[model samples]
Target: MASSNYEVIRLKRDLPAQGVVIHQITDDRMKTGVPLHDALDRLLEAVKGKVLLVHYAKIERDFLEAATKRFYGKSLPFLMVDTMQIERRRLERTHQSIQSNQLRLAYLCQQYQLSK
Candidate 1:
């Protein structure tokens, strides 16, 4: 087992992330060519007290849990913050006349002047 650590990450969606890519932000590393299990080991080490900021966390959460179970024979616990879900709630609470589809990652990022 590796020593415990903490890091923030934004999993790349433009590319296939599972079994293809995982970005380790602390070191600014884009790791590839490694097995997903090994990659997740690095991620899990830093899972403590951190909420993963995922674009679409509902789907991402299911995918991560399934992949973790498949690769490690057990699923690990982690927190996630879905930007899309939060944006949808914000629109509803603010009574903004916005379509649900407009809660997409690109639109939210653009509205907030963020690079996606």
Candidate 2:
């Protein structure tokens, strides 16, 4: 559904000047934030014919499916590449010992020398 009343998420960059680069969504924002369906509609339209690359699929898949079903009363059909699974498979194939944190997005990115 098309909507003009989407929630606006504001990020204050002033904290970064004080060396705090990570910003957390405050309780105020959480309570005021709109449902995911609105954003999902636009995102799905924009990413048509594009494969989404994500760190973990479970969370993203769950959220997308839930939103799609809730808003449109239909299933969401989309392609997604889970980097965490890919790295896990690679490590398993190479017979390397997998650490608990090895499959994490940040850890996998570090292994592949990806910049933050």
Judging by TM-score against the true structure, name the best candidate.
Answer: 2
Deviating ranges (above 4 Å) for candidate 2? 1-23, 32-34
Misplaced by over 4 Å in model 1 are 1-32
Cα error of candidate 2 at position 88, Å: 0.4
Each model's lDDT comes to 0.66, 0.69
RMSD vs true structure, all candidates: 7.7, 8.0
The residue-level lDDT of candidate 2 at 84 comes to 86
Cα misplacement distance, residue 2 of candidate 2 (Å): 25
- Point out the worst 10-residue segment of candidate 1 by lDDT: 23-32
> How well does candidate 1 match the true structure in TM-score terms?
0.64
In the range 38-77, model 2's lDDT, one tens digit per residue, is 6676778876787777778988788778878888898788
Per-candidate TM-score against the hidden true structure: 0.64, 0.71
User: Given candidate 1, what's the lDDT at residue 73?
Assistant: 86
